[model samples]
Target: MQQTTVAKTVTYTGIGLHSGKSVTITLHPAPINSGIIFARTDLPGIPQVAAVAGNVTNAMRATTLESGVAKVFTVEHLLAAFYAMGIDNCLIEINSVEPPVADGSSLPFVRLLEEAGSVEQEALRNIIDVKEAQTIRVNDSFITIVPYDGFRITFTSINPHPMLGVQFGDYEINTETFVKEIASARTIGFMHEVKLLQDQGLALGGSLENVVVYDDETVLTPLRFSDELVRHKILDVVGDLALVGRIKGHVIAVKSSHAINTALAKKIIESCSK
Candidate 1:
């Protein structure tokens, strides 16, 4: 397959998820093999940060990439859009540390990229083909990848809440499947944890419209899918793994978080070098 990039520039403006501040992002077409790069236009000199596992500085509540003094937060949503859309290279210019949390799902970014369109490049795609089984474990959560002809994911999310117990999803991911099955899954949070997160300066812009919030007894918002939570987990896996470029494998994840997902990404990067 050939590398691809947006055919034209597109811009979107909204409120940052963590910063709770207004920001604008402009997506520009990039040359072949340039990969996805993020530029912090608000910072001096407009420093750029590459979307790679090695540059990840934080994965607490979200993925954060850093290079030198420049940092970009909560990048997984946009990155997942690029991956599922088959976009190989892009230059993202943002005016804040975090991208807008549009409906707390990748669907908005998907539509934005669709508006920009896509054009094939002269070079071929750089695909990471998983040759052998690789697994990473963190506590009870684990992620495993095995050789496969195409990108696929089998995810299981386990929550003790009465409203959410165990959810499972299996999908062969592509543009069509992603748009239909995964892109609309919104991020989730619990009412009990809201104050704690806010005290730590997180989820400042989250709302019922942007996040699927659950209380002790029931979910505050209507679910898009019966298993929307797990579907969103799969969405996050796709986004976090985007750091390693295109992948051809079957991934199985259980209660995986950003840290665990990015650890698998780092593991993939390390194996490629050997």
Candidate 2:
């Protein structure tokens, strides 16, 4: 595959899930080998932060990138969209700490990329193929990567709630299949933890409309897939690993969180060659 970038520029606006404020982000086609770069349009000098594991500064509920004093938070969903779409180079312009929640799924960003279109560059694509098996463990959760011909992700989500129980999904990562199978899976949260999160000043823009909520009885919103939670987990993993540049691996995870996902991604970055 040749290096790729968007054919046109596109922009969108939405509320930041953490800030509870509106923000705008624009995507522009970039030159070959530019990788994914984030520019803070709202900041002086328009500080730039390269989207990579080395720059990953936070993995709270989302992936955040920081360079110097510049910070871009909650970038995983957009990164996931870029990864699944086979985008090799692009510049992301952000007006705030995070992008719009946009129903708390990657679907909106996928739509943006689809509308922008993709163009193949003259340069050949640089990929980091997994050459060995590796695993990272965090408490009871773990994520593993093994050599594979194409991108594959298997996710198992474990929730104590009876409504969630144990659900899992295995996906072959591709733009078409991703859109139909995983793109629309929204982020989920439990009702009981809302107060705690609010106390921590998190999930400020979250609501039933943006996040799927699970009360003790059941899920508040209708599920797009029976295993949507696991699918979303896979989506998160794909997004976090986008920082690894490019890869061919079969990733298996058990109850992985954003932190563990990023950790696995850092390992992939260390293991693979540019």
TM-score of each: 0.99, 0.97
Residue-level lDDT of model 2, residues 145-213, one tens digit each, is 999999999888998888888998988999888999999998999899899988988899999888989
lDDT per residue for candidate 1 within 155-239, as digits (tens), equals 9999999988999999999999999999999999999999999999999998998999999999999999989999999999999
Where model 1 places Cα greater than 4 Å from the true spot, the runs are none
What does the lDDT read for residue 143 in candidate 2?
A: 94
Name the lDDT of candidate 1.
0.95
Superpose all Cα atoms of candidate 1 onto the true structure and report the RMSD in Å to 1 decimal: 0.6
lDDT: worst 10-residue window of model 2: 265-274
